[model samples]
Target chain A: MKAPCTVALDRTPLYDLHIASGAKMVPFAGYHMPVQFAAGVLKEHLHTRRQAGLFDVSHMGQLRLIGVNAAAALEALVPGDIQGLVPGAMRYTQFTGPSGGILDDLIVTKAQDHLYLVVNADRKAADLAHLRANLPRDIAVEPMEDRALIALQGPAAARVLERHAGGAAGLKFMSSAAMPVMGFACIVSRCGYTGEDGFEISVAGQDAPALAAALLDEAEVAPIGLGARDSLRLEAGLCLYGHDIDTTTSPVEAGLAWSIGKRRRAEGGFPGDAVIRRQIAQGVTRRRVGLRPDGRAPAREGTPIADKDGRNAGAVTSGGFAPTLGAPISMGYVRAELASIDTPLDLMVRGKAMAARVAAMPFTPARYHRG
Target chain B: MSETKFTEDHEWIRVDGDIATIGITDYAQEQLGDIVFVELPQTGDTIDQGGDVAIVESVKAASDIHAPVSGTVETVNDALVDEPGKANEDPEGDGWFFTVTLSDPAELDDLMDADTYKAFVAKL
Candidate 1:
């Protein structure tokens, strides 16, 4: 049977570059992105770990919230302590709905007199609407459509970036500052989805091609696609917006309560703060946990997890054959009572139940540079 | 020497006497990136001409390998279970999927030759 054809939504500045590099493009989150290149997913993933990999994350939504008290206005909607964030620092936070459910997870970085934010491409429209409806009239949520975002990730990522943007070597994790990349003004942050020591560079769309080319010129760097990106993040135990965490799942149950600042939790002003605070105080009915399947058969998404007595415990949210682990691994939400490290569980794969266990998050230890 | 034939479905069969070795084409492996697992029928299993006899799962998607010709499965490549990347590394050589004893040798004539398969892939 022929596979369904994907309609191109929008092309990044590096669209032609991707094709020239032998990338296999696919439609994802309303944009045409490279799924894999000639190197294959496993090789691309391993290469990223051993060195730096360039990812075209221009499909993600980039916005600049400009106002006198922009942080205060944003703090009203999100649970993170945005007001206390020092200039040139970033924080990972979530947009909360009126019902206390999460709208989307995003990155908020304090820039020069403005707040720079990056949101998921699939939920950009919804995120903007939510921000406008709740934010006061004084604040302006301007979408930076002319900017393209790229991620340079891995242990050697800093070396590659510093070669262009001098002084970036001093930036710590979750920090951002204006830097000249390939002679273009860019906001470089020490952050990324791969859980590696990396930087997310936001540059002008027109300059993206040159900057991408400059990074690729380095002998240590190669173009990574969405296929490898997903596997890398999965191994890092990072939550994907739509798959792992969604509007229906609360941040507490998703094991992201640490993202909520202590001051914000005490003040209790953000949307869904009451419900979330209660979940934190009492406890959630279920919690997200990682699983390691006993065999090579991958426990794919939607696979039902059962307890020892054949009781439905949970369902696999994301699962695959982890190349690093050399076996199948999965992540899913399970009953709170059974959410413990080394807890034995069973995954139903193709009618045969396979043994599994509830392991701690980050199947692979995150290599983010805190220094 | 007998000629090898290719199917539009991407399966290739090299017939030598009564035995034929079947595997996927290079174009097919490229389309299915990073093969992670393979499921093959055991020896002695019967399959129709167009019936599915094997399966291959990649990180991106899963695909069914249909039998190119009606035959009884004579052998399977057991080495593929632990090293599925062999299909990606050498799809036509070491990655040969399974061997079958052809039930009808005449069915081979209906398949495309290497030249025709090259043209078919070029159109895609």
Candidate 2:
């Protein structure tokens, strides 16, 4: 159709650079982002898996929680073991509602001085308000609006980063450190949404273009867009907030129990901890699972799922053509009894019953740098 | 070297007497991105001039292919069903959607020629 724009969208620091590189820009989460470049979505997706792909993730909200009790304050809101998080280590967790539903998915890193947090762009305003209202008046949630986030992901990402920032490759998975990226002071983390081993670099917004250009200059790196990011994360079995998970879905139901630390599950202090604990013990009616459609027809979001008798079972949340799998893969909530692997099901596409099966998640194996 | 008529909706039709071949324009394929699957109408089915006919599903979205003129469907491109990317590769040639027996050859006169269609797309 027409280019994806409906309202006044924001631009990232690399916006003009993307256009100069022939990227097809579109509206995404209130920002005008490149969905594909001249190489197209399919090509960009595969290149990221095989080598490396540079992505502009500056739209995400970066915040610094400054207080004497930052981790303790955040632990009251999230289920993750923030108190146990060592400085320079990041933990993935969701901000939950009083009823235990997910407010948003975020990554919180225990920086040297204060706690660093990166939240989804769409939920930043509300996330900030929620934090401010919940935490004591002493804790200040400072927004880093002047910062830009870029991800260099794939198998060769480490070597490329090693060339520019020699200290980046030394960090382990989910680890962060302040290093010089392309001669600019940046917080480089060995983490990314993609299943590939990579790093997410946070730097001053003005220095983003130089950092992005330096990464693009690497032989293994190519500038990618959001289109490939979605597919790559889908194959990684990662949940997309407001889609795969939301205020209606809980952590246990969404299969994110691991994110809730063992001590937090027992302590029972965070918001909605009671409801989540009950779901974990008694189990949930519906659970998120991976689905493999029988044919080439992709069962997109909102596609209905049916049982053997053609009775309505559930609906697809995130579905698309997974480039790595070479076929269509989807993740959605289904009846708990039917959430097990190899459970035969049907995805109703265009009034026809397309045979499907509940398969193991992370449709593509993760290549995270564990060391 | 050729004569093909186009509709404002972006379909391109090549007529040979009463039998006509229908497909989307190059511009249409470019906008649709990579075609993953296609649903074509059944053979022998009758369609109105402006009725919604087949469907083309790209990686991004699914778009309905409207009938350019009243006709009876004769055959579909099965090759496209197996390899949908062919539509992106050669949208004007081997990517033809279907063949139809025209109910009225006069409807073809109302369509825009190659040169007129090119200028019309420039306005968009």
Candidate 3:
């Protein structure tokens, strides 16, 4: 097993609370974040599906793109329909490199005056640098270091949050509002990484612990760690940055073409637009697909995949035992010809070929509250 | 008379005459968190000392169970295949992975006693 790098680890605002809650802290993206709590990963994952699970996501980068032309300026960097976003509306987009590879995927929410953005923890510094370098000086990139984010996710998330912030319950999915939560003004976005009806609340760093404690006090809420967070997203078939989608993968190949608005596709204004447009017009050679291994033995990341004739097809990028499905699940890039649903494939595990098939994602259906 | 011995790798062995029952220590199960699956050695398979005998997969990762001494597989606890969590619940008892006929009884002398193993774990 690879040893965990523990040098110069950073702590989030809720670090003390996590320690008090018996969290198994591990080095994740340079932060000492909780991997699992006393209840373990399995129980926490189930609780999030049934009730509510509170996750401290302060490690993610939160920033504001200030200026009137912020949306148009950002559109030049990503394929998402940024300028089309109305106030309180959010769009998920990726920062594409000059070669059409994804620099990072982020959530861009149009606030009243500026565009609020949340990026991956590991890519925060690089994203900040990219935004600073690419975006014109007229658009100011303000990194919000004094804020902390908490995600209250699950079927009962809205109910648990409704008690604290009444206005938050009214926000539709992918919408955001500055609501008073626990006596502090917070940006409550009706969205979450988990495929459930949930909210991600951005609050002052100092008030984070208190706010998290208040929410955890609810009967339907439990403090969750990163372990459950991974399984929940995997079951949801969400792409994990640096794993399922990375610098070598294109948005079209990764099955994220829906995020590229129609206007952006026709207008052709973004880094690597030529390559992306070509790939969009014609299909990609390799495509991302979901794999359901036939047995209990999980075909983990980097597991080689073979075709029916025992020829090398592709490799698994992200995989593990899905607690919800009670079977091993995986997501990997395969030859375009074999990316069709129900395509029988073989996952090579420790020199043995395990039976697996390409299945439609998300291994579980998303339960987002559309209204 | 039967005597229990422990290896540095956290496996437990109970020797009765020439037959020895092998399983993981409670400490090993606790470290692995939840066991989702178990891959045990087949009956009649010959395993050398310290060879891979079984595999215990937790929600996090998989760990190999090595033989404490060279022996031929006699019987395995097939119950673990259906309920791998049994290893977490009763690691040293019903969680036994398999039993093997001892090929070298002298290898038992190198194993640590229960008290000595407990002291070894404490230092970790």
Candidate 4:
């Protein structure tokens, strides 16, 4: 989630820790979050790919949905098959509007008695309101406001985490378990936004500082900030809530058909099931694809995407210099016909055309711990 | 002999006779974080003081690099094209954006000197 430009920015539980570490804090999702630590974005970005980078993601809305019908209640909102989610497993999904447009992408996990949801901080209020109004009164959507989330991500994430909680090393991707770390109780999940083998640990707000400190104490771990996080996710080909997917962008157009479960696809129960099914059967007009801009110049968001002949094709949704690739990369929607890999295009930046081509995402391969 | 001045827009200029070399302030580069690309005005282009002339892109956002004084573009630092991070490494040195033949040397009178720029940055 991106920060709002308001003066009343809130602080995370680890605010003092951030200040002590010489982190450069900026307003993010109504909070004064760190955009970069002393290591800087470039080093932080590279460190996450090569080793472990710790991230503070406490601003997101962590909610617990309870009652016997919680799964069915959530299934009515998203296209994913929530009922099929086994305990300790996580599924990536997004909330859809009536027209099949995305509201916000989130992760859903099922536990012993409730469904765990992690939504964007900016849309938490509306999401809660939507749930309260739509779900049966018996079902409860309780916000976990007292918790702080910390992510330890990268190739060395498992080893770093294992130093504290030995069992964490055994958790596979999209799996979760309650672990006790340094006398603190926390829920650790084998998932992260950076497309790395990592874990997102949710613990009490007061325990965050110590937990974060312990993780950073690892030889391979560094405290990364939002700047590197954005670049990392972009290189991972993940969708950012407000930028990549929004109220007007459908899941199909956003290239998220895999998120829509087969059971839910055949049985239309979700909000935008009809439109989503239609787009799935007959491809959408536009598709989200990775772009490789030729030359050293970087093309940013809103740059016009044009064909070789300078005909308007689409617009860039996200673009930046990938520290891992050492080149400019972008992702945006283009005409489905032109979304094929290797399709030559140009990013019209500053009234001048920069050479670009549609390439296969993720710019880098996803190294999730599926085992 | 040359005089260096700074604009409220966070740009620094070194004036030697009618020629002025322009770049963003060290504070400006620090605030913008790591710069990835720089778009400079072509040589021979006439620009007004405070006119938008170049673009410096970081991983987080793109910031406008404005012309601090009225002048015609003489030459751009082509090296910034390949190594934009120089703006963060040596913002006032090798990161210099372009040189211009000042169309109005009188504009320099209103710009802040080194000490004044330092004080102004302290307040920001």
Sort by DockQ, top down from the best: 1, 3, 4, 2
Model 2 clash pairs? Answer: none
- Scored against the native two-chain complex, candidate 3 gets a DockQ of 0.59
lDDT of 2 by residue, B20-117 (tens): 89999999988888788887888999999989998888778778899998999999899988888889999999999999999988898899999999
lDDT of 4 by residue, A61-99 (tens): 999999998999899898888999889988999889999
> Which structure among the candidates has the greatest TM-score?
3
Scored by CA lDDT, what does every candidate get? 0.90, 0.92, 0.93, 0.91
Please report, as a residue range, the 10-residue window in candidate 2 chain B with the lowest summed lDDT: B1-10
True contacts kept of 2: 0.22
- Residue lDDT tens for model 2, A1-371: 36645589899999988999899988888988989888877889999999999999999999999998999999999999999988999999999999999999999999988999999999999999999999988999999999999999999999999999987888999999999977999999999988999999999999999889888988899999998999899999999999999999999999999999889989979899999999888999999999999998889888999988888889999998888877888889999999999999999987889999999989999999999
- Could you tell me the lDDT of residue A257 within candidate 1? 95
Return whichever of 2 and 3 wins on TM-score: 3
Docking quality band of candidate 4, CAPRI definitions? medium
A143-255 in candidate 3: lDDT tens per residue?
99999999999999999899999877888999999989989989999999889899999999999999999999999999899988998999998999999999899999999
Q: Pick the candidate with the highest lDDT.
A: 3
User: By the lDDT metric, which is better: model 1 or model 4?
Assistant: 4
Sorted by lDDT (best first), the order is 3, 2, 4, 1
Q: TM-score for chain A of every candidate model?
A: 0.98, 0.98, 0.98, 0.98
Give model 2's TM-score for chain A to 2 decimal places: 0.98
